[model samples]
Target: MLVFILNAGSSSLKYQLMNPIIKKVFASGICERIGIDGVLKHEYSEDKELKLDIAMPTHKEAIEAVLSTLTSGEGKVIDSINDIEAIGHRAVHGGEEFSASILVNDRVIETMKKLIPLAPLHNPANILGMEICQELMPGKPNVAVFDTAFHQTMPDYAYMYALPYDQYTKHGIRKYGFHGTSHFFVSNEARQMLDRKHNTRIIVCHLGNGSSVSAVHDGKCIDTSMGLTPVQGLMMGTRSGDVGAGALQYMMHQENMTIEEALDIMNKKSGILGISGKSSDLREVLEGMQNGDERCRLAVDMVAYNIKKYVGSYVAALDGVDALCFTGGIGENAALIREKVCAGLDAMGLVLDPVKNNKRSKVARDIATNGSASRIFVIPTNEEYVIANDTFKVVTESR
Candidate 1:
């Protein structure tokens, strides 16, 4: 079956057309600047790419342009929209309502609407994409693949915050981890690479602009670093992670700022950006560090240190880890970051081979010393494939 996977942001839409069984993406592209001047980049194959600047005043127009590009005569990927058997959407926050991918229906849409407060930055766009797809393709199956679903397996103790019981029960405020889809994909890939049984314990560090760590036991998430929101875990591109509540209150009072203004600072003006007073991109930070910038050096050190701290804590939580997997943008490409994270982890049985760590490859490969007890691997993540596969399964089972 051909699955069209979509990840819709507030102003952009990323799409991939793929067949889950063959693990092949027939076409992929992104629509950028949906509300203003728009650009649609369509890549049908490795050598064939088309960039078009068009007017996309809304998501519906963006979707229409994408469909036109896919079916256009000169560079067509499909003859008709009918070629797409199902649509898979990436929903950021499922809360506790969705534990797995499910077919989208009226009830699902309503529930997702009710969840808008939980994912103010994501769910509305996701719902808009789904609603547009339903209008354009009336009878085709649409599936919701949530980013929070995989972390739903986390134990209550691990997910609950230290807030009052009434706050949790009445306000639905608790640690709901993000990046669950990426963690799930990478951990399963690690299991395949290690040839391990179902119960193999693995700690997956998904490092990117947005980062999180998960301890997977027997293919289920036991604990994760991200809590309540994506901003609670690792220091990210622009987010201040794990700031003390008292500090926040003091800052708000000192600046005579409201709660929303303080939160805006924490969410958008902090992390590496606030520390280094530089670009949020890790590449830029690394370049600055190499040029003897103290703040950049400190930023890099802090990121690695934060990741290493989480690794140690997760190791203790899991009792012992069988394999440690690294994924996401920073995890897969930033060898220096990986090396720094594993530098002092020798006592935890993770010994990184410097030579292997330096040699980067697209495929999964171990970077651990030959005799290390905990094998270390670098596995790239494929969230689109996971969404497509889940969509196919849900659609097929429903039929």
Candidate 2:
């Protein structure tokens, strides 16, 4: 079955056409800068990059352009829209409404509309993309694979906040962790790679520009780093991460800043950028550190320290963790980050093997020292594939 997976954002849409039954990806691409002069980048397995500068004035235009690319004769992936069996979408927030991936129906669409306020920045884009897909491919089945769905397994205590009970009950105010898809994918992958049982105690770190860590106890998400919003947890590329509530009030009083302005400062102008007064990219931070930049070094240390602290906390949360699995851009590729994060973890019986750590293998492999009680692994994440698989299951099972 050919599944078209979409991850639509406010200004961009990413798509992948894959035949999962046969393990083949025919084409994948992204459309950038919607609602203005935009760029469409499409790449087929055997062809050079296809770049087009056009006016993608709306999500509808973006979808139309993607359809055109898929059907075009010049190294196109599919012969016709009929070849696309189903569509899978990456919906960032499902709130407390969706516990698992669901088939897109009128009710699902309605639920998504109701969830707009909770995920103001994501749900609308997700709904718009879903609407366009339905409009263009009238009868095809589409599945909504939520980023928050996998985290539904979290216990009440883990997801609740310190706010008043009435406030939480009146308004949906609590932690709804993001990156559930990546965490779910990587944890399962780690278990499979280790030949362990499905129920394994593991911590899956999805460390990227937007990062989070999930503590999976026996294949269920007992806890995670991101909370309420993506702005919580570890310091990210641009997000400030866990700041005290008092600081916000203090800043407001000192600067006469509105809540919105304060949010913008915390979410966009902070994290590595806030601390180093430099670029938010980890590579750049590492480069500056190598060049004897103290601020950059401090930024790197802060991130590693935060992650290390989370690891220690999660170890206590799970009592004793079986393994630690790293995924996402920085987790999978950056040996230095991994090394630093695990530097002092020897007390916990987790030590990195320098040789294995330096190899840079893309596949899942253990990088822990011989005598360590806990295993360490680097697993590449395939969130889109997870979405597509869920799409296939939901679509076929429904029929």
Highest TM-score scorer: 1
Off by over 4 Å in 1: none
Q: Tell me how candidate 2 scores on lDDT.
A: 0.90
- Each model's lDDT comes to 0.92, 0.90
- What is the overall TM-score of model 2 with all chains considered together? 0.98
Model 1, backbone clash pairs (residues 3+ apart or across chains), number: 2
For every candidate in turn, the CA RMSD to the true structure comes to 0.9, 1.1
Candidate 2, 234-297: lDDT as tens digits: 9999999999999999999999999999999999999988888889899999999999999999
What total of clashing residue pairs does each candidate reach?
Answer: 2, 1
Error of 2 at 167 (Å): 1.5
